[model samples]
Target: MNNPNALASQSFDLAAQQHPHLLRSASYNYPHRCAFKAVDDGDTQTVNQRLSISPLAIWLNLPARRFDTALGRDFLDSLIAEITLRKEAFGRRPVTQLLLRHPFLHYQGADITELMHLLASNFRLNHRDNSPIEYCAELLLEEAEGANLALLKGLGFNEFLLSLPASPSRGDYEKLHAIWQHAREFAADSLGVRLPYGYPEQDLHSMRALLDQILSLKPDRILLTPASELDRWNLQDHIHEHGSNSASQFALIYNALRHAGYRVLGNDCFVIGRDSLAIAQNQNRLRRTAIAYNSVNAADLLGLGPAASSQLGSRYESNLEAIQPYIENLQLHKLAIDKVLQLGTKAKACRVVADQLLCYHRLDIHYIENRYELALASLAENISWEFNAEANMELMRIHNGLLQLSDDGIMRLLFISDTFLAGLLKTPKKD
Candidate 1:
């Protein structure tokens, strides 16, 4: 199991089932598409996958959980240098961006404000001050203990996003207001925050309050559903006797955001007229792109530190969870990648189709069958299973090589993830 190659295989077969949410969220789909697992392992096959590929940029490391000025600067400089080298090696222009992952120490023993200050200094000193091309950075504020939206300016990241906690509450709505207020001040390019479920019919005010607050943020792009800790199926049966209560919840937020002038980009992500994503979608530029904001496209992420995950063109990999293994492997001049999944042609195509459905709730069956030689019949059948007796709905249809969901189903998108799995298995369960 320690063998990196074998671990990669196991990760695909084992971790994927257990960690379906990796694929559930439009943003987190990168790791799920690669191969998934929660273990200490590595992969060795297609070892040459790296040298043959071209990347937009090489990432710099994040500061430690607790900030150390010198180390963070060194990390930034090293990343910049690597970016230069990668650009040179590929014989491309000096147009490479740097990706910085949040160390996310939470409020346990660190202040995000200070971390922001440190990162801002590093960017000014290393990225913007010295570089000729407009060097940009994307901060995955996916995990942070507090919300000081002002801190983001110093970090110098063009794109900023977060995975809001799944437990939706009044305070959480207030937090969204603060985040949006700051996001507007800095024009925090696109924003994403999780919205948890379980709001009762009578407690509609809370849902309205939360959704309306998020609408007020007026973000250009929004990744709304980031995969809650609890799956819809796991909720009480009565809550979703009509299959799932997810659609109702999703509809609430969806309508509010739309009323506020936002339109759906794909499935779960939303964008207004001004955002670049909307521009691209208008120009017909959204073709096989990643769900991320500033990294090297979803497929080519370079996770530099422990707990970072990557999905390169042909390989899916992750770093060791412990710092020691990552450092030791680096010292030995070897890839610290402990988990890997060798992506084959069909899997890659399926990942794309899956992403399309997850994001847009539809797929080009014609394209898949014709291009990748994969069958949509199974996908179709799986979708059909969704509306079966268990879901308590007579909805869902597959026709003309396209997957379509009714207005009712759209509201239930949050809960359909399990249905997606059931459909994929070709056996829709009642539960």
Candidate 2:
């Protein structure tokens, strides 16, 4: 067999050179093309839009700046208003998961603990049904040390997710290990680690070493992300020139992890075989954003705080990333929506197919035929023919009434998804 790592590297370089967008599907926002718009408070139709589907998860993105009591309360009030509106519209199906991102950076000691309590209390009172909710917090490794873990656990934040540096020092690993032990003591339900690859210093060797260190602690799930061109996490001097070969390097790390018995799914997420993400993938219920979730049925996402985005049914809405505007709009009893995309029939179908291939690694022909009312047999035939060509690398194949992707195909999911999207776009819309 051809060396898997070599195949990944070759395919990755070609993807970068010719199919850059396809390679970019590895990023969280996969098929979404955001079109921003100014918020008009007078637009009642837009402002009054509510969640059409019961949200499975609620994401609270804390501002990077320190938290203020008055401002924080206003934010919470705005969140409550939004939830109330969704409940009124969709009826309370109850959100099963709540993820609070960058919480520790915003507050400390009693203040942070108090904020968590308030958030947990308000969310429970407003959104709870018979199902018990899972409360999760995503924060930096450094912040984990000083965070009031005991209080957070009491507030029902059972899951803790931390992002480590691209190149962690010995001290960093030690600190993480210490935090891991403490989290277990607090009865933390699950701990996930997000590790970024493609930094100037990271190669296959370095990444494997890093994986060894992290695996020793045995995080419930591991996410490997490409280092952003801009240092979003404030990693200081570790930020350097990110080369164009980062994707190729990421592919190498991915192949290495797979050979080591790690179940690396989608593009960059690695987990044990029994991890929820893996199970969700097998069950064909994995949904993706910045995080992955199991959506047994249709699932919506409600995002709060500055710069957040929500996927509510066929519509995608984003809040103003600017703190002042987000705060002022909410203060005026307005949803701080800065952009909206109402998915058309074609776009929605494209997303469904893309999600199936990217997350589940297979596309059910009958499922698409039944759901979209579009004949994909012709599309499948075309894909098979073209994929058989040398240039296309045969990344995908047709099995018994199913179109399944090889690992290489998953790496180029956006490309394959785009191909299907092109076919959908060509089809005449039903009158």
Candidate 3:
């Protein structure tokens, strides 16, 4: 791909095939490969060597689908086993974040509390801390009762990202408003609202109303996500049509939020401009993820639970997706990994540069060239970037060996980042 415009005009499926690693997401991280493997003592030794590179930040992700079935004793035992493995693998490495996604939808209230305490104890995380773990709960708004929020806060979750239904009812609005007030009273650090757009049923007016209600609460952040549920059945004609018009919707929301003195941070997140994430963005410390921000730069992520992904050094892997196999593996005291992708030296360099661009919207060109031993200047000279201010308002520029993105460039970060990604992924000519 030459530029953002070129990427926009190409066949998405074809581009994805060509650069699956680069095009994983326009804004999120996803593993590019999944290769099944058996877990045993040999695997354990491999894991131990990789994990010895410690002080990696921990992100415990509990995906909701596994809990859809009634919370059984076996599942609890699986949870204990996984936690034990995590603790033993990376001993005393503090968990910086916990993501409990929509657990309230399936489990009973008491069960939720029990699970929280279990995690808290094993993970060495509690409700109160001078250096608190970012415990974010992504719950359906309908399930975000005052009681639920209170329980979460009591269990060490400082952040809340509530998901709104495509077309929420008046009662839903009222409940969300009440929950916002409860969040304030309970001293929650951040309360974010997320709405999944790109469905035919949702109109701009209703979206506006939802944004208005969310803004009235003075939320810390607002996110707009694309709803791709229809894609499963190959009924994406409406989704595609609406997805195009959704750009206008985004322009409307972006303008409205900016007018209201809010900062449009990153692609889809709008912040009120004073919270930790917003501050992190200003200080260039913000690292955006699917659910939240990482304040620190360069921390490895270790994910636990069913289908969780991990990024440790040059290694990227995931737990078994099937709960039965995952639980069974842990029951047998083995690693529940389903796939592993060990990055090549070139791929690692590309990933690091891509991460810097995504995280900070600029690349320290000198730092990268020296560290990776790459001829970036000659490589950059051969590649054409969108640098004309007249055509695209100076989308990207390289001056004095510093590669930077303009505001418009940052808006098209995925494509811009992919340009360098493609270059780095190319096989080097042998001497």
Candidate 4:
């Protein structure tokens, strides 16, 4: 219950006072070491931690035990209300397509639509909502005649997923089947499904079987992700747990997509032919965001909620996660920011280059040069040497300032490690 505003600063002071060099980016605050119960996985801890996410995504995630809590619900209401009241300040939509923690909601005595509407508090989602923009390709395209055309996509104009229950019951699957059977009629502009890993009795056969069931829906795209969003979540292991290498696992998914006549899109996203994303990729115009591929720049993101993040200009900031602190700050009309990292020139330059590698899998050295006067020799003597220590040395190289990743290097940056990326980002020199 300390001032959430200073929590990030205090933690920074503590880390600097102790072990500053072990860290890399000062702006990238590690959540575990922040204001909450870092050591425990209790309800408050998780809620406090997760509530740090944007309100849309937070509601998607139901708390572990408490299905209903007056304070939590009220807090969530306030969060949305505040966002709704202030549009000019943030310049983000209140009715954005919220990421629902699908598998967590209970429907014993609740209407999913009503519950979703209540939670969102800012948008309208009907069975027939028709979005103005296309969403994720993971969904099977809708070709029905005026069926459910009122279900519009929300603020984040991405795919709408029926987050499968973590522990699905007969009823769950039945409900899911009913929805999927007529999902196309939902008038969804674009639809996608997120298939999560880490299920009971996980094996290749089970994976394939579950995948088969999902693919049978013919979603526009199939995005495979980890059920648990842990920082150390091993997606490769989830794909083929039999001690498979990254290359082998990559081939597994790549080949599977080919077998299904589906094209392997960037990251883990797979797309059917003629999908908008595929077209965008074909034209080299697609840009990836947390919500999936879009034309919006990732650097322009402004997050809200406890520990919600915002990356504006050359600075990054995140709110404090504790509910009391967040609510208190909002009541005081102050941004619930606990940490801020103002990026230096080199950091920004490196970020642009790194983001290219991350999102596009290639570096536009010319773009970096036009933006900043970064020298090729400085890049080699300093940046190159620094990265080589952390990244795969064999894949590390800086040829005339046009940094390119080998297939192995791209795989490393894309699939497994951010070690090379971390070294590229400059840490703040403590005063």
Best by TM-score: 3
What lDDT score belongs to each candidate, Candidate 1 first? 0.47, 0.63, 0.63, 0.44
Candidate achieving higher lDDT, 3 or 4? 3
Q: How many clashes show up per model?
A: 15, 0, 2, 28
| Candidate 2 weakest ten by summed lDDT | 34-43
lDDT string for model 1 (161-189, tens) is: 55444445566666656655666566545
**Model 2 per-residue lDDT tens digits across residues 346-412:** 6777677767766777888777767877666555656655655634577888877798888777766
Looking at model 3, residue 199 earns an lDDT score of 62
**lDDT of model 3, residue 110:** 88
Candidate 3 displacement at residue 174 in angstroms:
1.8
> How high is the lDDT of residue 414 in model 2?
55
For model 2, what is the alpha-carbon lDDT of residue 89?
A: 38
lDDT (10s digit) by residue, model 4, range 300-398: 344556556654444455678666787887777765668766556656655555456544556665566556654323323344344445454654465
Clashing pairs in 2: none
Angstrom error of the Cα, residue 147, model 1: value is 15
Residue 332 deviation, candidate 1, in Å? Answer: 4.0
Model 4 CA lDDT for position 372: 65
